[model samples]
Target: MNKNFNVIAASMIAYFAYRELPSDRLCRSAGIDKGSMFEDATMISEEKIRNLWVNAVKLSNDLLFGLHFGESLQLSALGIVGELIKTSRDVGTAITAAANLISTITPLFRMEMCSDEIHFVIKLLPTERYDHNDPVCGQIRDFLTAFTIHELDGLTLKKIRPVSVIYPADKSNVPEYERVLRCKPSIGDHVGITFEIQDWDMPIITSNYELQQLLLQSNATVKDRMSSEVSFKNKVTNYMLSNAYLGLPSIEQLSSNFNISSRTLQRKLSVENSNFQQITDNVLKRLAISYLKEGSHTLKEIAYMLGYNDPSAFSRAFKKWTGFPPATYQRNEEH
Candidate 1:
């Protein structure tokens, strides 16, 4: 799925990491050009970005390079939504809009903000899981967490440290991490950060109602346009994943959800060299792996979640998909 992030994300990394390394070397290592990154309305691929963090952390020899990189930027660095977020009437509005508009900047990532007691939780959920194999992805997660928090503190005129953090990295007591993030990282199923609810309603210092409305309209237009660029297979898969709570829809039902006949759906999928069953199997495999990797459910529970009645059946299918059983794969990943 060619996931892309705004060029500014790459530019920020180069600008910051280069302070300790040569500019040319950093750019070459990251596979990003110094001049091209500063261009307006440009994008950088996720693979190059993976290279960026890998080299940035290795060359700088900073364990918390991602946290530092994110803390250095202001809200204005978020390409298209920079001004929009800055102009939001309040912190809550700014953050909610930022979460929803992330797809405009990077089509796959999204944030889920929910009120939990006296705190608001923000979880970064990227739709495309294809790039999760990158070793330095944990750094990218830290960057995002600190990036949003820094902007929140700036806009709200209050130091809003996350009460808890859910990062991809293992738990650590790194003092620098606590200093930068105001909390240490904890491995969780998703990328999450928590903040006090009192900070939510704080008015943004740069709130500009009229300009914000205009920016909102412009962002909506861009988001709608980008929706067209997404593949039909992706759209189907995302829909299935999103609605999995209601149970994975059948091919006919799934096509109905897309407002098309099964034949039409199959035909379109054929152009992509895919079929409905393949899409269904893809979703099942993804869910199965996710459940196992999380290590929070029993095989029986996972089988039920995947719509299988027998644990043995789920285990057999999992073995067929991979060389080992679900439990074995989970154990290997843990080690």
Candidate 2:
């Protein structure tokens, strides 16, 4: 199955607001439901996203539509970028933070930032999973390039402009594109813009140090969750939790899913300060507690659900897991 990716639906909402076009018509043309396109959904299929760009261009009859839409988008309308602006101490930090957030959270186009002694540059690069030949990809690239420049200018109180602009092979001399870009862009294999080092350090007028620290704490929490999923132990635990309804997968089953030998899997888990049995016990303990709290199943049924041979076996394990027999735990929870 193709994985759906998270996108800022509000950015698309701003697109319609920019072009003064009915989003319902464009979204429908893209084979998407209008109701969820802008209001509630954040996950969109790659196909629909491309279709949306294509349809918007077709309906609006404008090739530089993304440039205009990007210019029209307000910095405050960008939830992540808005947070980045108010929380970052300077333009460099704000732009870098926004780029990192977008790249980390979305699969469409990953933004990368790098700095040298005299300049800092940001690039809008396609990820390995996407097909660059797709028209929608090109359109989105244009949109993002313009949007980045516009947001940077807005947040920095218009104190800075790109020292250099490098555009992809598709060059347009359209007046609107020229007006937003400001600089004469050179055609290159990559899409990026560069700013002087001094301009990058311009302090954000509304930036708050306290808010930036709080944002750091919040970002660290999210990073920890993401990193936890990357751990082998957590991956195995998640697998057990998700498939437990069919009866928790044994170490052998999990090892097979991961395309490794069972002994190898044990060694890997041990390296993570965990082992199969320990993890299995932990998962069962959690599930058993949840089941007991729900109070929907008898001890015998709960035993069977946990894959025990009999109620006696489950009761013994449950007692060891929680220091209370299944019936006692369930009764206590109910009361």
Candidate 3:
């Protein structure tokens, strides 16, 4: 299937404003057609989506661009997903709904919620491979953290602050992180935000169960239509993208999801002039470019994200794909 992913049009627009560049130039530089991203319900390649972030940082020369962009996002920008969340019966249900339907709004990453005795955590992990050490990755984390907290506060009409914000990247702009998150962020292998457990049960000011049920019904119909219309290749890719944080899926796993034999799946893909390895490589390549262009991750980190145990091996493959070392590619993008 074609390499396409859907994103909210408003989110894309807000991200582009980082440098105050005209929309056309931003689109042209990012390899997107003018006015294409602004259209409602349009899908663009994941490469282009990544390029928007890479290019936004490059154009603005702002390491904290993602954080600022995320802060500027209005709750209305969430579109249908925001509407569904708004009408939820409580904060917990609204978050659950957001987690379940996040892919419909932004196919780039997966968000999961977990709770322990004293705290509730929301983890954000990329659906496609990406280096956690990358600045763009950090920026993305910042963006989501700020945007989510802001929305939660808005819905509840109360100050909602996380107890802690954990990031995978090495620390940079410490004061900025603290300011935006309203807490000192801890640098670690895990990337998530934790809230006091009490917040989980907080009631949303606009809770409406009846409207939520109706919206959920409509959402289900739309999702069913999307699933039925996309090709098997797309279905496989989408699954891989959403579950990438768990690691790439094996052939057996992919086949099992479709209730088909591995050989049968292979034969079907061959008829489309595509195969699993090709699809996986395409995903890896797009992700690699995204990480490289962000200019923050070490090659080793990028290698790990792409599933290579050896950084040298990843470097070799990256060189093969783009005809330049990852460092060189990153430097060129930065300039």
Candidate 4:
């Protein structure tokens, strides 16, 4: 919500990778001013922020960079910060503690960790729209790679593997993947980040406990304020069920249907834990799947339903969403 948050969030990644990529090249490609990225605190447009993400990905060849950046920053910094907060604890409590502390610094992402006796699942939720070019995403990948190594180094985790984003056996990036994960990397059908939970009972070694408690308390208070944003998010999701395919509606039109000011709608949705873009994607994914299954509509038809004008563009998006071509999805569904 802060004006300069995107630039700062994206730029810190440039800072992190500055040695590998010179400052001038990264800044020019990312469309950021060298000095202002760190100094300017003004809120930037979503367009500019998204462009930063796009540029970062194109320049770096990292698809999941923004998301990786988001998750890793919290994991590392907050893990350290949480250490100053409390004593030994379970993975769930430690993660919660770290999450609470990290939310204070940046509301761009949140994490949920849970288990059902088999393994621990950590869900990373982005609070804002993701940019394909965001250097932060790459930072995130580096962070995960680094954190996997750190946990292994700490002797808390013996092996680190990703259930998703598997590296190809014959690919050139295999060495990089192996070095980062510190284990044999397997690429599977899963699409997001997952770290193994071998020692759910590992002990944390940190000296500060009181600071952790205070950070948790503060997080609790902020969460209460943001709860309404969740409802607004759901409502927005419901609104776009059949509408997003028509075109992205104005906030005013959407708010009018709900009988409130667009400002009030946004405020409440912020509390409910959603936003327009997120809702739009939710609806689009659903609609795209549905249209694909019907077998009557062409790719162009599906794209138009999702508010795109061309079939080629739709095909590209479909591939991105499902990791398969539209024709492949249809053929498989038919079989």
Candidate 5:
């Protein structure tokens, strides 16, 4: 990735268009373009995408990032529709009625129940960036934590653990997690924050007698919304790893195989939060480390596998990346 990323008010734009703010200065500071983020998806890497989100939370100073954004759009739209149906039901009835009609609001991003184990998981597609304390992410977590607690009254999460974050958390936010989640939420790690529901079988406050049917339907919709493109990226990376002996693919070859224009292919990957060169480097780096650990291939063979014609050139590059030659790394590992 170019490392030039900008923080724009995309969610605000989605909510109150007038509230949208230009991220040009932020991008300029971060070395990215503000105007082209919506169009030039490749300009934003996953880390950068997540950074934008985290910045949003900091910019807004609110935890209900997702809900606030959603309220402006989905929830607001639902309220308009709910007025026609609001007078006809109880709280539970209103909830059930809202769930069915709110699919439009819930579709782009949402939470769904899965069996007795998982309460709600964030499902977002067509989003490139995500990070801890990301206004949207924080908003979703806050909404889930608060809504779940409010709805069940007795149900409260024991702890909130974040599996991923672009940056570390401060002490102030730590206590808030303890209070809100009834458990400390871990940040900068790769484990989901778990909320233990004592009565997993408790029914939602909805008019529908068959709560299972609604949950099942919602789960199915979430599964259906998941794109298969994530798997495709893994495949491409794996292919690069195995064929390291070959030189980098020309843009034409990659585009031809994927049935897309070179530019379109690049842009699509950017939307997915990465670019070809970035993935290629990551794959190569992973494979290079593994090969070094094995210590079986000769320098010449290793060089060839990495698409370098000369051992000396490969050694120089390796030293630059890892600050050690292959022989020294292999010997240290063996020791």
Candidate 6:
């Protein structure tokens, strides 16, 4: 539906911590407008959110930026979603609430939960594919895992350490993982956090059934409002945003998903004064800018993600879009 993230999680601490680094400059470097963050109900591009993490790490020179940022996060930072989790009767219910409300809180990723007799595993999958070697992605994963543990402990009033925190082998912050997680972290194929099964049933100290019911109603209202406001164009763009990682979809493919003929889809888009090609170009432009700004991936890597068969072709496309080669654009942004 808009492929956005609530700015509260990124901007709250950023406002105070980044005094020397103006938010406007950061937003521009990330290819987002500064005014987006100042709205009453601020919602920023998911790409901007990722770029923020990358830039924060670059500016702070902190390998543990995500872990450190998450360590200080309070329930208030998450708004109603945090409230819903805090008021749940048990840790299991809290986890469920977090899972259910994640799309409303942040549509950047999806949370998948699996449990065994001895352990419960929660895996974080990005709504789009990212470079596995990008440390910013790993750091954000670390932040989310650590933040979940921290929130659960706060609600249950116990120091509940996960059995293990697993991150991609390519992440550079190896030593800091153990320090931040307070457990031996494993380098693995999956990005997930595993906790002992016993903690799942732990009763929350702040559980309030009445308050939770009220929050649930409030959450549904928010979701409904969001759904009502999303136009068909946005729905198509959102789908493209998530699936662009695999490859950009053709008009025929997109129309098929909507159960419409290609001509019908074209007509609908024309009525909105837009077209599939324009939307695809916009998505590619945004991603190209974000990747260029992040500066971690090579031109080839970014090219592949944008569905280019060759780096030279992608470079030409990027130059046309932004009036500068990708490398030059990145260097200028750095300056």
CA lDDT of each prediction against the hidden true structure: 0.63, 0.63, 0.62, 0.48, 0.42, 0.62
Model 5, TM vs. native: 0.31
lDDT of 1 by residue, 1-335 (tens): 22235444454443342232444566688787655654664567777766767777777666776676676444235454556544688888888888766665444467888995699888888677526765565676666777787666545534577889776664563555566667876766777788789878888754222222322332222222123345677666655553343136688656543435789889988999999888888877877787677666678867875678788998998897887999899999899
The collision pairs in model 3 are: none
Report the error of model 6 at residue 193, Å.
Answer: 2.1
What stretches of model 3 exceed 4 Å from their correct place? 1-9, 36-42, 105-108, 126-128, 133-135, 207-335
Tens digits of per-residue lDDT for model 4, 93-205: 56566556445434455655666565665554555643435455444434434443333222221233544434323245555455445455565422234555654555542
- Please give, for residues 38-85, the per-residue lDDT of candidate 5 as tens digits: 564545554554555555455444544433333222222222333423
**Of 3 and 4, the candidate ranking higher by TM-score:** 3
Q: Which ten residues in a row have the lowest lDDT in candidate 6?
A: 217-226
TM agreement with the true structure for every prediction: 0.53, 0.54, 0.54, 0.39, 0.31, 0.53
Which parts of model 6 have CA positions greater than 4 angstroms off?
1-4, 9-28, 31-38, 105-108, 126-128, 133-136, 169-172, 207-335
Candidate 3 per-residue lDDT over residues 1-76, each given as its tens digit: 1222344333444334322334445566778764444455555766676677787667666667677655544332
Model 2 spans with C-alpha error above 4 angstroms? 1-7, 36-43, 104-106, 172-175, 207-335
Alpha-carbon shift of residue 154 in model 1 (angstroms): 1.8
Cα lDDT, model 1, residue 149: 78
TM-score of the candidate numbered 1? 0.53
Judging by TM-score, tell me the better candidate of 1 and 2.
Answer: 2
Q: Give the alpha carbon lDDT tens digit for every residue of 1-335 in model 2.
A: 12212234435533453333465677668786644533443457766766777877887776666665555343323345657755788887887777776654346688888889999888888888557777666676777787788666446534256888888745555444555676878888878888888877888756222322322332222213222125667656654553343246667556644445799889988998999999999988877776666655667756765677678988999899889988888888778
